[model samples]
Target: MAKSFTKMLRAPDSPVKLSKIPSDAHPGVDSKADALRKLPKFAGRLADLQERLFAQAHGGTKPARQNLLLVLQGMDTSGKGGTVKHVAGVMDPGGLRINSFKAPTKEELAHDFLWRIRKALPAPGMVGVFDRSHYEDVLIVRVRDLVPRDRWELRYGLINEFEQELADQGTTVVKCFLHISRDTQKKRLLARLDDPTKLWKYNTNDVAERKLWPAYQEAYESVLNLTSTETAPWYVIPADRKWYRNYAITRLLVETLERIDPQWPPADYDIETEKKRVLAS
Candidate 1:
């Protein structure tokens, strides 16, 4: 059941046009209210799995080297931050590493593009969430021509190699591309402008970036096509409705952690002996 839901959301290997996918899709969900209602159930399961994964990694268990990394890529106003707040917020913060990658700082730029990305990877038994990740090198860098086409084009392969290495090292990578319609983006951006509370999120540059929507779409298509691998496949979540977005992502994370099937490590000492000692004390 979880596999089927994940299969439905996984991006196809063939080239895709973002317009072709519905931004408000709610597979297996009846309505917005239904999705909202179901979210907490999924969140609870995710929280439990996270605790087990953390325990396995830190409880002096032998050969403890498993972790989960969720990579989120999307246009501005596509709800990356919202997903983190709603879905990842349920997990134990001690076992989670949430990294938001923005423009490269001078020190970051001085090193390779993935230098900071590698440093931000979650340790064994941790859940790492990247709000905007290494794919930015291929997305905005390509659309805005921050780097030459020749250089950025080569990054797809490098990204694939990097992810493959992560998989080989026991880190399960789940990449999600929040797919929002142009109209939805416009509405969201406008809502930000109208609401004083959300005004801080309203960036004038977002409008400029929206102008190159077609270019951004093309760049993203290239990413989903080139970087979506067996080890680190990309899932495109419809983001028109915030409720559905949260539900889909929470479900995905729940399914993913279930597949990992982390266990609480066995006690090194005899449990009965420990219990007897505690009772005697």
Candidate 2:
């Protein structure tokens, strides 16, 4: 089932038009209620797999330790934060590291773009979540013309190489673009403005950014085309319906972890001896 969705949602090598994809489509999910009901089971499996991965990294004899990094990229109000809150929230916080990347600091700009990203990577046996990532160097920089075209254009290969290195080092990279339609984004933004509690989330800059929607979409299309490699492919998740978004992401995670298939390390000490020692004590 996961394989089917992976095939359906993965970006192909050809050019893509974000408008062509339906943001509200729920493949294989019958209804919102059904999605909600299945979420807990996927969540539980994710927790268990994460625990096993953590244990294996700590105790397994393998030379390269294993970890998972989930990279989320999306437009404003496209559900990146919500995905982290709902899907990743189910995992044990002790084993998870959620990093939200904003505009680079003066110090960060001093070094290469990936320097900060390297610092935020998950350690062996941990699951790391990046709310926005290195792709920003291409997306926002290109859209806002923060950097010259020549500079930002060079980053596609660099980003691909960086992810390839991570894969070589035993990190499973799962990238998701929370694909939302223009109308859906506007509706969500309006909702945030109308609700007092969500007013804080409504940023004036978001409105400014929306004015460049076409440019951002083109930038993202480039991102998906150039960087969706076999080692770390990108999944374009439908984000119009919050419930379905959560379900799809949770399922993707579970599937990725299952593929990694970490196991409980064998006991280093004799189990009988430990049991007897504890009982005697």
Candidate 3:
């Protein structure tokens, strides 16, 4: 049997050296055409499973309390938005909740770091996608020294406990770190500058952040090592190739929903009686 993307991409339990892992490697896929060919099949399966999950929730009196939360974290221009557009966009919109986190507001800053994160969780039977999620509290917040050392340092354990609670409550947390090379990022950034249509996507801060590439990488390495728990493990997706990245994530989503195996709830009323009433009408 072919290996599952989940197994192939899942980060190891021990510490990982990001510098050693190649960002351009495309495992289990031959080429962009190969990935594109396989995606539609996976999309069909994904749509069906998503419908089953949503039906289970809205159907019978005893609703299933399972949901999925896909957390996307990566360096600048790692294709987080593109992944959402291609992968989660193919699923039923009624069953998907997408939230993109940005710089914290004054009100958000008043509360604990996870205050906003708690509100963005996916409802039962829904697939939630977080674009640059709670990890920012550690990643950017640490790299930029937005907060003091002791506070941000302690958030690692807090995040672990929070994810564990989600797992216990039937939430399958799929954390993916979209790994890309420095050169690829530079080309992508340059492309943004070269194209008038893509200028809106570029930010001056991106260049400034690029200068801190090594620091961001070090922070990511720590995140992968520290918070990759058994319940909510991290997957390092080689995202230099956009086609493979989309395909890998879609495969992971399909396998996860299949594992849940949500079923169609039986009708509460008698089918014969309903049929007879409809005929009489």
Candidate 4:
């Protein structure tokens, strides 16, 4: 039987509903060390793919622009930062870009939701990662009752159209939601509260919001349902284990960049020759 992550977890709204895989599917959970021992293989595969992406830097066109975009969305403590850091670490500086979005300022909230997001697009020949992306439109807005349910719900179509545009324009958009069990998340949050060094990461308010876990879960389920597509599929990662989460994200990114196959533009030999002749004259 093929391994299935979905069989184990509850279904999300995404068309490709992944129920949690049975415990028998991966007894690896019983041994964190053993499960972790498998990470190097996954990382190695990702590294190999990154090597190709690095080598192919400008293999595609004259201008050699690589417009790859990765959007990562997850609940707090889902290891979004860790995944992105490890994924981009293997690529050339020129091969990648990263944008981290925070709570919107009054100015940001004033404009259309995507107004701020569009301005952050990476230049040609770079893999741009959005730590938390426009999906927040569907996530936070719906959860906080900031917008009417119907209004926030409708943004899903707009998002699909927007991502489809990127796909048509040669940008490979890979989105992901780091899926951590609620119990696991609670434990992690509590750890943050207890650890002196990590205390600052813990916001008392976060616990308050966390108490409304059902609302957040519903919001995520809705976002996943409407947004997952062939052109821009959302990878639902198991993130209770940070190492596994990072490895999974790294693999997903490597696969997307490989598919894009960006290449550097070749120099115009005739123009160079003419310029050289003019210089000699």
Candidate 5:
């Protein structure tokens, strides 16, 4: 039997040391070629499952309350956008809700941190993708000291409570921490600088952010430890190899949807009557 990336990549209940984890390792895949070969099949399965979920929501007498939310968190250039392009981009757009949360706007900052997050959550039967999510309140905010120590410290519990609430309300939350080596980030950043087509992605702020990599890692470690719960667990994906990162995350999504096992809702109208009416028309 194939190994379950969901199990292999999931963050353990105990503390996780970022340095001890190998960011470039491909846990289940043999090579990049192997991952590339399997990706299309996984993507196809994901699409089919998403269709079932969408149909259940729109076509059922009692719509399914179940939905999915995929949370993607990583350092700069860990391929969160690339994952969305390759993995999520394949699914039907109608069934998917994609949100890329930026720094809080004036209105967002005025409200509780989760107020904006709540607004962006997926409706029933939809698959939601958050590229950089609520965790940033603890991560960048903590690393940059945007809030006081006591203020940010409390968010850990608040995040846990919020995620547990999501689970109670029928959202299957899959949070992935894309674990990339610092060296890989350096290479990617340099590539952005060197390639004309990629030049627009290059940012001076990214260089400045690199200086605080240690602090960010520390913040992430705390997040993985504190917020990883039974209801909304975190999976640490090895992301130095982009192909494996995509493959692993896609595998996780496929398995999760399969477990949900959404079915095509039964037809409300009588089939014979509908057929006869169509023929008469």
Candidate 6:
């Protein structure tokens, strides 16, 4: 079921576009260990691409702008943080703004879900990450019935429209769902229990939430059905196989950034004159 949902999300529209294997298709992948091997290479490539993006921004001076936003969603224990750490660690921090989304604070809940998200949008020549995002309104809020069915149902159009606006404005947005099996989550949860220092990360609330796995699955299906768009689609990362998941997501990011073909801004004709003028000082 997760496999089907993930496939629907990542399938390319044209044969010419680079293709990537959805992680959910792989039942086993040790993403952490594999990430150690692939991170240097992929991270290096991302850094190189980011340098071009940075040049684009700096060259703009007082002119154009561009940026990207990556939203990651997953069940508890999914490797969202790990993937972000390894996959995006190479990018320039000068323009990067990674926002880790969690349960809304009282002040945040007073407004719409997207209100908080809007505050974190990436500036030109940077990337932003939503650890968990507005999608939670469609997933958790629906699974837990925190809101009426109609209220949550309306969010699909809202999300689609929101993403459309971002895309129209030149923000390359990608949404990834880290797919983990119930058994895998159980194992990780147990390991979290036995480990001493990791104890602080354990939460009975997360365990209690595990009981509603089936509900979350259904909520995800609905969320995908409504929100998957050409501009911003959800890519499923297989969480069971950590290596494969890391590789798949890293590749997907590279593939997407490559699509943008972020180019360095052309050198202006006034550079010589500007340099001489500055040199006089």
Candidate 1 lDDT (Cα, 0 to 1): 0.90
Candidate that beats the other on lDDT, 1 or 3, i.e. the better one: 3
Alpha-carbon deviation at 234 in model 4, angstroms: 1.1
Best by TM-score: 5
User: Which sections of candidate 3 miss by over 4 Å?
Assistant: none
List, residue by residue over 68-162, the lDDT tens digit for candidate 5: 99999999999999999988988999889999999999999999999999999999999999999999999999999999999999999999999
In order of TM-score, best first, we have 5, 3, 2, 1, 6, 4
- Residue 74, model 3: Cα distance from true site in angstroms: 0.8
Candidate 3, residues 95-177: lDDT per residue as tens digits? 99999999999999999999999999999989999999999999999999999999999999999999999999989999999
Worst 10 residues of 2 by lDDT: 1-10
Off by over 4 Å in 2: 1-3, 60-64
lDDT of 5 at 218: 95
Residue-pair clash count for candidate 2? 0
Please report how far candidate 6 places residue 236 from its true position, in Å: 1.3
Each prediction's TM-score against the native? 0.96, 0.96, 0.97, 0.79, 0.98, 0.85
Cα lDDT computed for each candidate against the true fold? 0.90, 0.90, 0.92, 0.69, 0.94, 0.75
In each prediction, how many residue pairs overlap at the backbone (N, C-alpha, C within less than 3 A)?
Answer: 0, 0, 0, 19, 0, 7
Please identify which of the two predictions, 5 or 6, would achieve the higher TM-score against the true structure: 5
Which runs of model 1 end up more than 4 angstroms from their true locations?
A: 1-3, 276-281
Q: So what's the TM-score on candidate 5? A: 0.98
Per-residue lDDT over 179-212 for candidate 6, one digit per residue giving the tens place of the 0 to 100 score = 7887888988898899997888789799779999
* RMSD to truth, every model: 1.5, 1.4, 1.1, 4.9, 0.8, 5.5
Q: How displaced is residue 97 in candidate 5, in Å?
A: 0.9
lDDT of 1 by residue, 1-281 (tens): 33355788999878877788888888768898877787778889999999999889877548479999999999999999998998899999999999999999999989878999999999999999999999999998898898888999899999999999999999999999999999989999999999999999988799899999999999899999899898899999998888888888888888888989999998877889999999999
Give the best candidate by lDDT.
5
> Candidate 4: where are CA atoms >4 Å away?
1-61, 264-267, 270-281
How well does model 5 score by local distance difference test? 0.94
